[model samples]
Target: MSNAIDFISAYNTIDSRLRAIYRGKGNLQFSDLVRRCAEFNNTVRKYEDDLLLCARLRNVIVHESKKDRIIAEPCDDLTRLIGHVAELLSMPPRLSVLREKNVTGIDAEATLAEALVRIAQTNYSNLPVYRKDRMIGILNNRRVVRVVGQALERGEDVDVFLQTPCSQILQAEDMNRFYRVLGRSDTVQEAIDAFEDNRKLLAVVVTESGDAGDRIVNLLTSADIPMLIRILEE
Candidate 1:
């Protein structure tokens, strides 16, 4: 009975928060509000199954007759469920404003040598390429090396390759293969989905609200996801 009371209390808290969230959006019923919450955020969507189960449990407790003094005993699963819902309601970190490592970028007009030097200094493989405010592409070490190798094979002077403009080596095919851009408001799950959907996708650039024309505010590489998962777990 104590566990059931605690579970009911947690469920009510979640339900009230949900109602407050959707109150101004539209005249949605409780069920519709829950659906909309899942639709609006990928993180919330991840907990959809567990949330729905909580909803059913809420219904059972709220509708119980006055004569029923006892309710279902809570298990470890109930404790976990309450904790997860609380975390979700609190709004997990946003990729746009994450306080992780600073994102570094290079100019499209920068010399190949400049980009190489930056890579060596930062040890960051993925670098966003921008021309002023516009993002042109991402420069990865593999592609940069490949371009230099092709130039050397043609008997071109090493100095010529070093002085070449970064954009000159950026093929249209490479941009499509290596990079994707997401909005600032997009959840981390969206970033994960982008990486999973594109096997060759090496990085995701978070722009102002996910637009390519906006300034790159954050960068997520395949390696960053595991770190992000660890942060979320904590």
Candidate 2:
């Protein structure tokens, strides 16, 4: 609200939610913040600002929990969780060498089968699908089997079935603005959290000013973030 991006006193601006978040710093992930906060009455939703912030944190918690294969339900107070998320989201994202993504991209015109072969050769879980210099979407290795199975079911050519651009599968928009948006950070956790917060946002797109706006770089599930985290640690 101050337009200064200082969340240090964001709690002072809000109600008891700040207290809730401050109280639960032990469970640091986003979903836990939401789950813990959800246990509180609906009071969190009353503060529209706090509610929206908590929702984003919730997404982070849910996503990370799934990636780690944790059976956590994240039960904490909502008001506290909202404040924590507010502070966290206001901060810029962290980046890694993976975020550097020194890898080459594939053309959208490539056949699905060809792309699969390339992906296989590289041993990557996903490939960045690009239309020229612009990143379009991601081709996930896991989807190959499903595509093949569907091809077998429909009696269609897997090559043709998969020849389309990866944008067809980009759960978010393709934009240049997201490129390097995460910048550099002190920890992999910060970078991972940033990806969770903005991976599906307009920040993924490129604007007419040649800026990264509403742009998605490549799809990086919470799973990918951890891998980057590991790589960064090494």
Tell how far residue 62 is off in model 1, in angstroms: 9.4
Q: Model 1, range 152-204, lDDT digits (tens) per residue?
A: 89999999779988887777777678888887777666677688789888888
Question: In model 1, which runs have C-alpha deviations exceeding 4 angstroms?
Answer: 1-80, 86-92
**What is the per-residue lDDT of model 2 for residues 1-234, given as tens digits with 9 covering 90 to 100?**
321122323433433443453375464443344455444322332344555564464445545655545433333455445445454434322343334434545777777767778887887655666775665555565455666687779998765777654555444423332323332333344444455556643222112232323233333445565575454333
Model 2 has a clash total of 28
In order, the Cα lDDT scores of the candidates are: 0.74, 0.47
Which candidate leads the pack in TM-score? 1
